[model samples]
Target: MEVDYVVVGGGSAGCVLAARLSEDPAVQVALLEAGPPDASVLIHCPAGLALLAKNGQANWGFETVPQPGLGGRRGYQPRGKVLGGSSSVNAMIYARGHHADYDAWAAEGNAGWSWDEVLPYFRKAEHNERGADAWHGSGGPLNVMDLRSPHRFGPIFVQAGMQAGFRENRDFNGAEQEGVGLFQVTHRNGERCSAAKAYLTPHLARPNLHVVTGAHATRILFDGRRAVGVAYRHERTIQSVKARREVLLSAGALLSPQLLMLSGVGPAAHLQEHGIPVLHDLPGVGRNLHDHIDVVQVVEAPHLTDLFGLSPRGIANALKGIVEWRRHRSGLLTTNFAEAGGFIKSDPAEPLPDLQLHFVIGKLMDHGRQTVWGHGYSCHVCLLRPRSRGSLLLASKDPLAPPRIDPNFLADADDLRRLVRGFRVMRDILAQPVLAAFRGREQAASAAAVSDEQVERFIRGHADTIYHPVGSCRMGSGPLDVVDAQLRVHGMQGLRVVDASIMPSIVGGNTNAPVIMIGEKAADLVKAAREPVHATREAVAA
Candidate 1:
């Protein structure tokens, strides 16, 4: 098969790219996904996400090598495997990150990526329920709505934050990020508005667009220095397709770099070690990996609300919840566990808030992988920025082999210091009078202790990633930079990486919204700069 453009990965960014690129009825586009179509209720119902990590149906449940910083324990990295990608399985909170984040990208010599320049793209992709404002948008493909029914404790968490001396702001994605409030979600009529549902599904029937699920792209076919096609495995058969214009890599941070390295575009020595001859000896293909390392503090709560301990009565309550949700669609089933959260400064001296908090109305331990028999609200206190760096390297020459992921969590001393302080602040907020009615003993004994040395030790043993991984294929002019400001892979032709991997730094909050914005901008980049292609150059190898 052949097309004008071949897009790898029908993920968050890929969905946007395929939809927007195919908008030009004159062009043809193909989107390849390794997983089956997203048709399960586990992906649509907001509460069904409670079973996400265990439900292997739509996730690439990749585990990392044991990190020394995390007490030699391997960390879990669950990425979306189905259509719409992580957006379909995530908490549904819509966060674009701080303005300073994008400003820093521009300051790092990446043009056309400043907050001012990127805000327009953000607006272009959003259909915010709040209507059009200077900061928000309408009439876009993606839907952003206020949660129809947040858990009862969502407001209590905010009030407790206020009582603990934090400001209560309505919008975290507003002028300033430091405040506690109810989070706005990316949902429509209580169902998840995944990228596929918003973008790809609407355009799938267009004659110019083609979507192939369960097709795994194994390599990008390069004629010398220019990419011309791709080889993929579909239904246990190896097939090749040539691109007339370009091959856009949107395989995400983990797999995008993996695919590049597989195609011999990564570190030359590393590729040689795996017995793969080098194509492009880019030193930065799989470096600068980092994430929001966080510690979850679960506090057993008093029986003052629906979020409480496990018992016979709790079982009855859950049954009633099911009936209520199925009938009205206005019950707890519509709740995204992380219904309330905000940003804060661990130290007042810092210019901006570096600490972000997520209040889950259930006992969440180890990304909800650990089952503790009880209902207790959890607080996730993660440092917004960390100074540690990690790497991704191919384990072998096989295209299906897992890549080695070393996030090197908490390798920096400053990260641990800030997290310890944030933990104390979290305890303070929970102790506030507004939450006294529900506040119970800390699940982790002495979780409120402030001894610097002890806190540091506790953080070292307790902290894990909050799942926001980026900078593995960062954008910059440095020697290790992988892509340019326009998201074109440096030194590579007829190819671009339009995904979270191109992020120079991880955004301050969730990655779903920012990735969608990247896709929107990337489509414009291609549409504006696209030129007539020479048909004779088309080449496909299987």
Candidate 2:
């Protein structure tokens, strides 16, 4: 079927763009999702995020090539494949990152994308609990609310941060972003308010907006230099969908660049190796890959209650609460489990916070690698802005085959040093009197016997990704850049990338909120581009 816009991937950014672009009523939009619908009960429940990891239903379950830098361990990279993408299964922490992040984009020749220009888009997408203002918005589709029933250990983590001399921030998305506080979650009542739920679901009734589930886009249908449409797979047959105006690819950081590469839009030599005819020869399509890596330091608590024990009686309470959510729109399910976090600058001279912290009530050992009983207060420190950079390249031309992800973590000595510093800070947080009150003892293998060298070795053994990946299709003004200042593909027409992949650099915090804002702003760009063409036609008619 022919549509005005064919959006590939019904993920976080695609959902937003599909919803906003179709709002005009004159535009026909087709949103293709590779996975099933996000109607699962676990999706809405904030505490259920852990279960979604590595699950075949909603997660993509992609892994990286063994990293030689990190003792040759192949990292498990789980991205959401369902309707809302990773945002559907993510921790639900509403972090917009540092203002300097956007400004850095502008400094790198991405005009009109400075912090000032992008701030409005961020504010536009958010319906904050604190109402509308210069930094936040209200009455938006995505609802941002404070945690309803914060975990018992949440406050202890906050107090520990206070003891460490950090201030308590009521809102991380407001004012300055450098304080410990409870995260604002993407929830409406007790259900998860993913981008798909907030942006796309309400607009599904529109005749112009067609949401195709279980349709996996294989490649871009290009006419010489312009992306004309997409060829996707649904059921057992391959189907082609034509875009009358434009084909927008929002397949996210990993898949978007992979699609571009598979469609002959990436590095020339690489494409030749795969026996695919080169279309654009854009070297930067998959050159710059980055992610936030974190090391989890877990400790034990005797009286602490964990999510695993929430059974029969606990589930009855949860059902009653769900009923309340259905009736009164308030309950315990409204909160994200990892309720509070913070951004701390390790050094005083730093312009912004370099270390990001997440405190969870459950025992987290190496991204759920180990199961330690009893409730525990776990605090982790992530080097928010890393100096290290990695790359993603095609292993083959096959669309279903996962790309080669080399997130060269700890390749740089500085990154290792910074992470060590971050671990030390976490140790300080754990040692504090308030947090110590709940702590029975250290539970980690490395923590049992302490040494700076052992801690470094443990970090190398235990550090895993924080699930925030960006910069595969970097946006800039350079020969290696995949997309330009206006987010247009470097050499293709009627095609643009508007996802986390376009980020020239990774943000200082979680990437979901920034990705949503990218969708919001890209919609404006699409409309603005259409305006000029419409004006020219009207002028000629007049």
Candidate 3:
């Protein structure tokens, strides 16, 4: 097959790229996805997110190597393989991060990426249910709305934070991101409004836009130094498709680099070691891996209603909740689990909030791998800007084989110290008057420890990822840069990466909203270069 563009991986970014590029009636776009279509009932239901952690229908359940910093525990990395990617399976929080984060990108020679410049894209992609404001936009594809009916315990969390001396922030995406509040989600009414549901689904009828799911991209087909096509495996059959204009890799932070290495476009020494021929030899293709290294303080709250647990009464309530949700779309099932949270500084002297919190009305441990029974609440306190960095390397030359993931979490002592502080602060918040009504037994590994030394030990023994990973294929203008200011891969032509993988650093909040913004910005760049590329398509097309 041939098209003006071929976007590999029909995840969040690929969905946007295929939809936006095909807006022009003259352009033909093809989106290839390794996973099945996002048609599961579990994906659309906000409460179904928990079930997905165990169901592998639309998730890439990848695990990290035993980390020395994490006490030799393999951290779980669950990335979405379906249409909207992680956005489809995440908590549905709509956080753009602090203004300083984007400015940091601009400060690093990445022009047009400062907070002021990127705010328009954020507005452009949002259709806030609260209506348009100075910081928000309406009539856009992505729906950002207030939860229809939050759980009973959600407000208690906010009230508790306020009672603990934290200010109430009506909007985290608004003026300041330094206070506690109930998070606004990327939902419409009660269902999940993923990128596919907002952008791609509405345009699937367009003849120019075609999507092929269950197709695993094996390698990029390059003609000399320019990317021209992609070779993929579909239903045990190898297929090749040509891209007339450009090839965008939107597989995500983990797989994007792995695909590049498979295509012979990554580190020279690493690729050569695996007996793969070299293409572009970009050394930074798989470097700079980072994420929100989070530690949770779990507390039993048997008094809270509509909370998830495994008691006989809790089981009955859950069954009743299914009926309530299906009948009116209003119940505990409508919640995003992380219904309330906030961003704050562990230290007052810091520039921005180095710590982020998500108040979950359930016992979430080991990335949902260990399900403890009984009603409870969890506060996720994550180090927003962790000092430690990790890398992604290929396990073998097989595209089907998973990559060797080494998050190297908590490799820095400062990260451990900050987390210790965050735990202390979160514990104070949970013990406030409002939450005191429901607070119960503590569940953290450091529950009995109060000293700094004990806290650090608990962090190393228990802290894990909040499912936000980025920077493997970073955007910049340096030796370590993979993509440039426009997200065009450095030292390469007719190729670009439009995903969370290009973040020079992880954003200060959840990654889904920022990744959608990256897609919106990348769409503009792709269209801006359309004329020149279109004129030269014949030469590049096979």
Candidate 4:
């Protein structure tokens, strides 16, 4: 099969790219996804994230190599394997990070990505239910709205933050990003509006747009240094799709770089080690890996049946919530689990908020993979900008094998120091009088820690990724950069990576929104690149 563009990976960015690029009837776009369709009830229902977190269906249950920073523990990394990508399985929190984050990307020699410039793309991708503002947009593909039936405990958490002397911020994607408040979500009504639902679903009928699910991309089919298409496995058969224009790799951070290396486009020596002939010899295809290293404070509040849990009462309430949600799309089933959260500074003197908080109305032990009994609440504190970096390398030359992921989390001493400060602030907020009635004894590794030293020990024991992994295929003009400002892979032609992997640095907040914006901007860049050819064709015809 051949098309104008082959979008390899029907994730957040690929969905948007396929949708936008196919908008012009003249263009043909094909989107390939490794997982099955996003038809599971677990993908649409906000509360189903808990179940999805534990079950590996539609999720790439990848694990990092043992990290010395976390006492040699192998951290779990869950990325979406289905359509809409991580946005389908994520908490749905709509955060854009701080404005300065984009500016930092531009400062790193990435032109046209400054905060002021990229804000337009962010606004362009959003369809905020609160109506259009200077900071947000309306009538766009992606829907952003407040939870239809937020857990009652959400306000209590926000109030507790305020009581703990933090300011209240109703919008994290607004004029400022440093305060505590209830988070808006990427939902339409009470259902999750994943990228596929927002962008790809609406345009599936477009004859020019083709979506192939359960097709795992194996490698790029290149002619010389120019990527021509993608070869993928479908139903135990290796099938290849040709691209007339370009091949857009949006397989996400972990797999995008892995695919590049598998296709022989990474560091020359590394490719040679795997016995693959080097294509472009780009040294930065898989370097610069990082993630938001997170630590959670779980409290056992068994009496609060309103919160999610496994107790009889909690189960009964959840059953009733299912009925209410199915009937009217409202109830506890609408909760994103992470009902309320905010961005704030670990130190008052910090220029911008260095830490982010996610107040979950349930015990999120081991990324919710571990089942804990009774009702409880938990708050997660993650160091937004870590100095530590890691890499993504091939475990084997085979594309079917998982990449060796090493986040090198907390390798920088300052990262741990900042997390320690953030932990104290979160602990204080959870202790506020507003939350005292619902608060219970601290659970897990945190319960035994008291002093700062003990807190650091607890963090090292329990901290893991909050599922935001970026970089690896960063965008810039430096020696180690993989993509240029247009997101085109350096030293290669007719190929671009449009995913979190292209992030020069991980943003300060949840990365879903920013990645969607990257898709929105990348679509324009791809179209802009095609205009000249179209113009010449028109001139010849005239």
Q: Judged by lDDT, which candidate is best?
A: 4
> Can you write out model 4's per-residue Cα lDDT over 1-542, one digit (the tens) per residue?
77889999999999999999999998888999999999999989988998998887789999999999999999999999999999999999999999999999999888999999999999999999999999999989999999998778899999999998889998899899989999999999789999999999988899999999999989888777777778899999988887878889999999999999999899999999999988888999889999999999999888887788998998899899999989998988988989898899999999999999999998888899898898889999999999999999999998999999999999999999999999999999999997887548888578788898999999999999999999999999989999999999998888999999999899999999999999999999999998222111211111
Model 3 per-residue lDDT at 441: 75
Give Cα-based local distance difference scores for all models. 0.86, 0.82, 0.88, 0.91
For residues 1-542, write the lDDT of model 3, one tens digit per residue: 88889999887788888988999999999999998888998988888988887666588899998999999999888989888888888889999999999999999999999999999999999999999998999999999998987877888889988887889998999989999999999887678999989889998899999899989999888777778888899999888788878999999999999999998888999999999998877999989999889988888777654588888878888888889888987777888889899899998898899999999889887777677777888899999999899999999999999998887899988888899999999999988877776658787465877898888888888888998889999999889889999898888888999999899988899988898889999999999988344333343333
My TM-score estimates for the predictions, one after another, are 0.97, 0.94, 0.97, 0.97
Show where candidate 3 strays beyond 4 Å: 531-542
Model 3 deviation from native, Cα RMSD in Å: 1.9
lDDT of candidate model 4 versus the reference? 0.91
lDDT of 1 at 296: 80
Give the residue spans of candidate 2 off by over 4 A. Answer: 54-56, 306-332, 369-372, 531-542
Model 1: residues >4 Å from true position, as ranges?
A: 302-305, 445-450, 536-539
- What is the C-alpha lDDT profile of model 1 across 108-155, one tens digit per residue? 898989999999989999999999998898999999988887777899
Record all residue pairs in model 1 with backbone atoms less than 3 Å apart, i.e. clashing: none
Candidate 2, residue 224: how far the Cα is off, in Å: 0.5
Q: Which residue pairs come into collision in candidate 2?
A: none
Backbone steric clashes in candidate 3, count: 0
Report the lDDT tens digits of candidate 2 across residue range 247-364.
Answer: 7889888899999988889889999999989988888888779899888777766454443323454456566767776676565555565787789877767789999999876677
Q: Candidate 3's error at 161, in angstroms? A: 1.2
